[model samples]
Target chain A: MKYPQGVKRNQVNTPRADKEINYGQRGMTLEKDLDKTNQFYLDTKRAIIHKKPTPVQIVNVDYPSRKKAKITEAYFKVPSTSDYNGLYKGRYIDFEAKETRNKTRFPFINIHAHQVEHMRACHNQGGIVFIIVKFTVHDEVYLYPFEHFVKHWDAYLGNGRKSITYADIKAESILLPIKYNPRYDYLAAVDEFYFE
Target chain B: MKYPQGVKRNQVNTPRADKEINYGQRGMTLEKDLDKTNQFYLDTKRAIIHKKPTPVQIVNVDYPSRKKAKITEAYFKVPSTSDYNGLYKGRYIDFEAKETRNKTRFPFINIHAHQVEHMRACHNQGGIVFIIVKFTVHDEVYLYPFEHFVKHWDAYLGNGRKSITYADIKAESILLPIKYNPRYDYLAAVDEFYFE
Candidate 1:
């Protein structure tokens, strides 16, 4: 059955050419991969992470039938917090997923000011907060803690570099493993870095 | 300054007549009241609850300038889970808020099937789940635990009553107090009922 836009579906097909070129490789977008991983986590009763719905300013809606309400006019709003958050081992887990084509540095522009502030707020409230940085060219992912991001964020404003070098990320953050089913097992990195 | 459509602003003004008549009364919509309460919670370092932004499907966007990308066409999407979720004392808090015109009963139709399933999933993961019900006619609010809601929900599916009576709600749920700043201080009820 054809589903409406924004409905969650498991079997998302990537472009055929891309699929053929990247066979046996996790070539999907970071968000899609994370969604799969979160779904796997939920299904296995391990965690319950979810991407927050894209904020929208709705002005008009059309109801053609009792069962259907189609939004006719709306605008996307900037998110105030991270993209993903949920419960993990009875603790709140919040993080934003960002991908960079640059293999040497993760650009600071990939993140927003409000998101950093939100991470600080969550951390102050004793929640586990981090950022998932994906080096697309290198095909590597890292779970970088919010503290490290904040350090670089402040330094950039005070005569430091505009980006965090891959060397710094390697030194400070935990590397995530890419699996077939759960795709990006970042929570494993969380378990090692935060819990252990 | 003109703000974006969905940005939360504190100084929302209702009409003059409504303001005058409902003066000294919490006459704002359940959503507005909850937003105020959540803001209060955030400010006082009590909790970090946030209403999930309404989901939207973007069909088109126009970039008038390099920095300003305006969404030209989009549609709202139905939410799959509760309206509000956050952290309280290092525990996950998830809930939905609903208002009813009926003074006697709260119709189960106000909630969707997916929301019920979502609540169950959250509960299974050891998250604190509940529903905030507002009887607009009676000007009463209650924090009804998910367990209680589930009991009635299942009963309604199996030849039971179509709605939960106000008498039953009064006996089973914690009544929320309306205040000036926070508006609906439901967390106080949560503390007394769940943590106490």
Candidate 2:
């Protein structure tokens, strides 16, 4: 089987191949890094965060051959909340991970009102919600509190800045040690925030 | 301005109308229904729930026009959990909705192992995790609790019954009310389950 360019396929059990992913918008994808990170947490049993299933809204299928069926008509389903969620030491963990090349700032338009609403709901339920932001320019990663993200979400309405600056991120977000396994190391941040 | 057959021009403000949408195998796509349900909930303020954004592993994009871009080379990010989640009356709600035409029993293969783990974490954190099974043949929807799903899920490892029958659903699952706003009054079920 031929894999696409920039996609590194592991031989079943590769060690942190995803963690070492190049995020220069050419070598690897954001989801890969997040997946490796989740795997690290799961393996260590330190936290239980996960990316939810893809909602495939199947409209039609074509069976070109007897053994295989072709999904001729399928629309991506609209989900009901953030991309990643789970539990860590009995606290609900919910969040979204985003990557950008614009080193100056992280855009708020990447987030939607419904996502903000979902975060608030998780908060009401006593769950922790936040975002893992990666600045490929500086090769940096930060976890912005859900509260901060929500507070600044409505800023676009007031002619405020469109993105969260590195300084703002440093002030409002927790910097995670990018590891080979679970590339983002988000649980460490979680430990520092709610558990500690 | 030729649009792909699977894609639809949204009179309701869908951002990706120009993008190709493959609605595979069925006229009613689950994504659209889920979106409508979320919109209804948002408009009515019954329970704030929203689906997470699609985790696109964008490998390549073709700029057909300044206003339009077609994703040519992309692969699924191998998501780690389910599609829907939010809050209802101060409780975290996480679930995956699925459909089956099988008249006798629903198939378990439709679910993934990662989702099971994610549910376990949520359940451990006092979050309500479950599945929405829509028997398209009977036009009946069943909301099965995470415990029940998990129980049956584990059973698959020990001949625990591969699929839960519709009759079993009637006994174990909660029957949600159909309302004008969200259509599925799932919060009522939550109130009945968590409170009582």
TM-score of each: 0.83, 0.67
Q: Which stretches of candidate 2 lie over 4 Å from their true place?
A: A1-31, A52-63, A66-82, A99-127, A149-156, B1-35, B51-61, B65-67, B72-80, B99-121, B135-139
User: How far is each candidate from the true structure, as Cα RMSD in Å?
Assistant: 11.8, 13.4
* Cα lDDT tens digits for candidate 2, B5-29: 5346553356544322322233155
Residue lDDT tens for model 1, B101-189 = 78799998878888898889889888899999988767888999998989989988897678999999988899987779888899888
Backbone clashes, each candidate = 0, 29
lDDT of 1 by residue, A145-194 (tens): 98888899888879857899999998999888888989988888889878
DockQ each candidate and list the results.
0.40, 0.12
> How is the predicted docking of candidate 1 categorized under the CAPRI scheme?
acceptable
- Taking the tens digit of each residue's C-alpha lDDT, what string does model 2 give over A43-117? 776766667655555455456655444444445555657778766675667888887778688887767766677
